[model samples]
Target: MWVRYLGFVILFGLPGALHAQPCGAPGLDGGYFVPLQETYSHEIEIIYACDSGRKPAVEGWWATSTCQNGVWSPEPQCIGEEDCLPPEIPNAKFNKKQNSWYNEGNTIRVTCDNGYELKNRDATAVCLNGTWTSVPVCEISNNTCGEPPQIPHAVIIGQKYQASFAADSKVRYKCEDGYSVEGAESKKSIFCISGSWSELPKCSRGTRQNTGHGSSVEVTTSAGSGTQTVGGGSGSSAGGTAGGHPTSTESGTQPGGGGRGSGDVVHGGPTITGSSTTSVSNDRNSKPAFIPVNECGVSPVIPNGVVVQTERMYLKYECNSYYTRVGPDTVVCTNDGRWSELPSCKEAFCVLDLAQYSGIGIRQTGKEYIKEGETKNVYCSYYDYVIFTCTQGRVTYTRCCEAYYHNYGGC
Candidate 1:
């Protein structure tokens, strides 16, 4: 008996086996553990499974809990179908295989409505940890345009009927009589490039006539008001010349001598005199404002890819794992305020197809998927075997055979 005690001590160590406490039932709800026992020793692991049509609240159908310090670590429990409901997405719906409630590890595919596309091409969501993965978003395609804006005092040249327009469609605007486009010599036009329209043109009063005396005098009248503006130097009054800047004083006097307003002016500078005040604005030192051109919007989005902005107008594209990038990776904002041709990502692996080869034996009947640079083994017979490798969706294989296998020409 003493020798037997020594063997027990050697196997389980000294004080831990004798002093360590055991754990009682884990008290799992909607599930049960295997190999039931009244108490479990420390560090003993038990497999857990849920009832029919149920799965562990965790990621997988089955789970394992360990007994530690007189308690179960995870305290396993099962989740019902109500835990996860079908994901709802705008402008999109799940395919026919969609279930009312998805179990853990189940996947669902979706299709977008007309004129809309999935944010991530061919993306699917999987149920995990009692929740669903990120669902694909539906967005309007970049090639369509909404209704064009209306221009004030101008009408569309053609029929004003359609609610929406296709990409690259141009709409011409004709100003009403007595008003022409502010700076456009030809007809005003705005094009619907991509998904937005170009800047709209403005219309204003046109053609002002000047008539005065031989002392370089000019007279003009306001549109609706009877106020008259007279400017010219009469041999030496320090008045503004017809085409030159004012040097001493400028005034705007109401016709028929109703009221007069006077203001000081800078030498060799343009001046503006209003009818109410006696002050004038000097614009000799003001610099011209600059406007930037070709401002692009947010960068284009790609499925299974990421973008890194290298500059204000340039970005670099990179594909996720198991995908191959096609076309240029770097794109720059063009002069038309649009991004260059965007790149695409293609799956870099091939699905296993044994239909082309004869006498090939596979464990499964349907197709098998694999990433690039991975290999799959095929059995042709007792003495024949073939190893296949996938690269960029193409599959190639090599055969190994003995003397008997070579003579039999495989299965």
Candidate 2:
């Protein structure tokens, strides 16, 4: 009976009976592999685990790598959180500890050096994850000044007395009656620097010459205002004779026309042209000013290129790769204030002339053409093999056909 029982166990339980060894897909280190001991007869799913300070490098449908046979994909790793590089603030300097790198929770201090003051509410930066907060700016004020100094025996001419002067303020002075400086004295004036006045000249007693008695007097001024001015003098008064300062072929109307209300003088073309005398009709009429070159309309805009600069009379066009400029690179301003020659950028193409070999029964398949850096395979009945390539708008060919077939053996 014992022998029979042992045989039955060996035959059915050992080799064929008990659960068969598993060959199902394996699971990751931190994943939930259901029925850890499941066999081929059943399927199992792997669900990954999550932890603090780390996240799935991949997720959603990307959770699984394909599995074949019994092998599993590489385990998905939870990457560490990232940190950002140090932030840079313009016009301001940032301070950090030596050998210190920006990481999570680190702070940076910044401040301005030049008479510059901060424009932002905060000057410190803190690192969070991979981003930084807003930064501050250092700015300088160009129009702030203090009090103007008083000089003895002199008073500012045509100037209202303001307790303090701002930057770029000017004051003119003339000696009290009968008092004057030595020979050849130019006008006496002083400009306000940062907070004080620039160097000034003294007025000493001297002789005043009147070149009026026999000489004729003529006074004239130029139209428009700004630094570009024309000041004229009479025989006895102290201004110099004003005449020529060339005008541009196209004179611009000051902004808002006749320049009555606005102070902007918009001129086109070169600097000088026309009559320098005060012809600009103190006209106060609100008519639009005339510019010479309405003729030079809008500049040409290339599809994939740009005009880097257009300051002078002539303009240049810039193009990118795979494109060629068909005309002149520079266009000069014409007499009418228009561009003399306009250029265009065209797409470069590689050309092939199979017509030259038409007698050999070789023909292009269609009316289409190939662009630069392209190639086409040709089927030549008389010659077996030929290949052609287009590069930089130039056509090149290679001959692979044998010597036995054609009149032109190779190209």
Candidate 3:
């Protein structure tokens, strides 16, 4: 029987043990005996099955025992799936005073006022978790002014206005004499940021004095004065009339005086007596004396002619002669008449005979030789006829008479 029980325990596990409970059997000694009764707790331990063996028991595990009372029991099993928690949501807040935001993964944008700008972040921001990785802050941005107005007689202080300037911008003021600053005397420099000037310059009446000479003229203005002196022989003068009359002297004896006179008389006043003082005067009071100034002293004008002498011929005047100056030392004439140093005649020469024919008396063919005022012609020794002319003043000829008579000359 014991062997059968042991086999059952191995085949059917602990479940079979419940069926085998309450069995009475006798020992070899013949004494009465009962089957040993045992008790078990209802608790069990479970481990995770992984590639690296197993993890510590997290679920489906009992703390103390696996079985309880007379029943068979098992520990609860853990649901074996991926059990990771989702990421935590971030908390975000806006800082109204700072005009920015705090946190990561959260966004905040910035804008500026009309005349101002954002000194810091100009875009959105993000918040991540409990802790903000990036915090954005907005600051004041712009601080500038417009161009200052232009001032006459005053110079600009410096360059253009800077929104962030400390000092060093300055302007200076000045004016002519008798002029002063109306408001502030020492306040030549003005602060640019305030946009105010130092003061307006002012002008007052001034006095002036003429230094020298005849009519004294004065010009006065609110700012200053000017003076001018007129008349006198050797000084500066003023224009226009003085009192009611003209400023120039009325006496003709003065250097630039006007008077009525004729034939070189200094009139309207006294005259300086020189070696020759013929006090000439003019009857017409309206006209002044006329004194001509002499430019040419003692020069003579020569006539034009051609004068001929025994040894020289002076071809003086070819009518309407013209001379052109070329340079300092050269003069050119239109005609061919020119003289080097002296006027002299040139010797005239001419050939005595022109024809080669040999004859004594006039060989008259059908031609005849007339006297001075007549036309003439002669026959050549070899040809027909030719004409000859005599000298203007006189004419004479001598030849071999026999040769001439034999050679066609009728003796």
Candidate 4:
């Protein structure tokens, strides 16, 4: 009876073990599968899909895989020529926000920078298969300024007259003989500011008085009954006696500050004194006080980054594709006339390499590419899982298999 029972148990259990063969999760490239599970029953089928701009190698945008005796039939794969990545155009920008990839037949609008125009017939580009068409080229604009405005009594210095001048060109002028620039504060050169010439400086007929060596001379006069004093010395001397009072005058010339005073004169009628002191304080020829500029020079160069905006006191930057900024994007001009601390561009995305963690089992749907700072959960066994965070180009987390084996005995 015992022998008969043993034979029955072997026959029944052996057949059961042979039919219990289940297939492991299928690995799909360039795509993903739906209803992911650790194991698939025999003859079970699951749907699979490809990313944008790709199609199943077999046919169509989607296909199916069937589990057969611990193996998947006709391994599923997504195949495509390629995808249209963001284009790099000098002095040009896209009209819409950029994405990682563009599907076939996708269209995007492009715009040129200031003072530049698109060289292409259209401003739009279309993605055909894996190539881009109608991509724009930026070129300097043709807009120009005609001959600089003619000054009444001045001529352009070091520049010949021309029919037209390019944008941002500069033309300086000098006053003709016996003529000087009018306003105390005026720019001597005209600039092409934003495709237009700046206002021209006026040339006055009379020349400005030149006070040599920053010095000036004064004149004084006196009326009747008024005692007059003329001198360059501190102590006064009697020039003559008038109305019983002695008039004093000093002989030598004494320079006071930047001005010099001549002797005094007597006139008739009521007392009338005229004293004029002309100093070279407001003279344009005098050397002005040195003032330090509170602005920065050229912005600092950043790796894998571009300056979006630069001004006297501020600078802003943007990173290129697949790179992330590690610090503040905007920097301020410091008191030392230099830019503040700059930022750096680091790897911004990572690719999940399942082969590196092959011992661990993945339970949830996984993405091929993970952005920096993004988190995903992966499984090691039926009861063990780990959450991984992507930093720069790496994904880091404690291994779920190590914890599962130590805590749960086995899967």
lDDT of 3 by residue, 308-403 (tens): 211111112221122211111111111123321222222222222433333533444342233332223444444334444333323333332333
Residue 245 CA displacement from its true place in model 4, Å: 50
- Which residue pairs collide, candidate 1? none
Please name the candidate that would achieve the greatest lDDT relative to the true structure: 1
Better of 2 and 4 by TM-score: 4
Q: Clashing pairs in model 4?
A: none
Best by TM-score: 1
In model 1, the Cα lDDT at residue 320 comes to 89
RMSD of each: 21.3, 26.9, 56.4, 29.1
Task: Judging by lDDT, tell me the better candidate of 1 and 2.
Answer: 1
Candidate 2 error regions (>4 Å): 1-295, 302-305, 351-387, 391-394, 400-411
- Scanning candidate 3 in windows of ten residues, the lowest lDDT window is 325-334
Q: Rank by lDDT, descending?
A: 1, 4, 2, 3
Mind giving the per-residue lDDT tens digits that candidate 2 earns over 186-272?
A: 346665433445555455343323333322212222323212232122222222333232232323321111221111122221133
Give the higher-lDDT candidate: 3 or 4: 4
Candidate 4: stretches off by over 4 Å = 1-82, 96-98, 144-181, 186-411
lDDT score of residue 382 within candidate 2:
54
What is candidate 1's lDDT per residue for 1-411, written digit by digit as tens? 999999987977767667777898788777888879989999899999998857775557799998887878776777684356567788787853333456556667778764466684645776665577777787766655677787777788885667666544667888787565533232577755445565566554443323232222222222222223322312222233343343223343422222111211122232334443323233444321211123666667899989854443346688988787787565656555667778899898888767666655544356777777666776766755677778657887766554344323351
TM-score of every candidate: 0.29, 0.23, 0.15, 0.25
Local accuracy of candidate 4 as per-residue lDDT tens digits, 1-411: 999999998988788656767889988877899789988898899899998857665545678988888888767767565546567788788854333456556677888775566783357777666668768887766545677888787888888777666555678888776555533222277654334555556665431222344322222222123333222322211233243222213233223332233311111111212233212222233321211223465568899999886533345688988687777665655445555567899877888865566655654444566767665667767766766667757887656754434222232
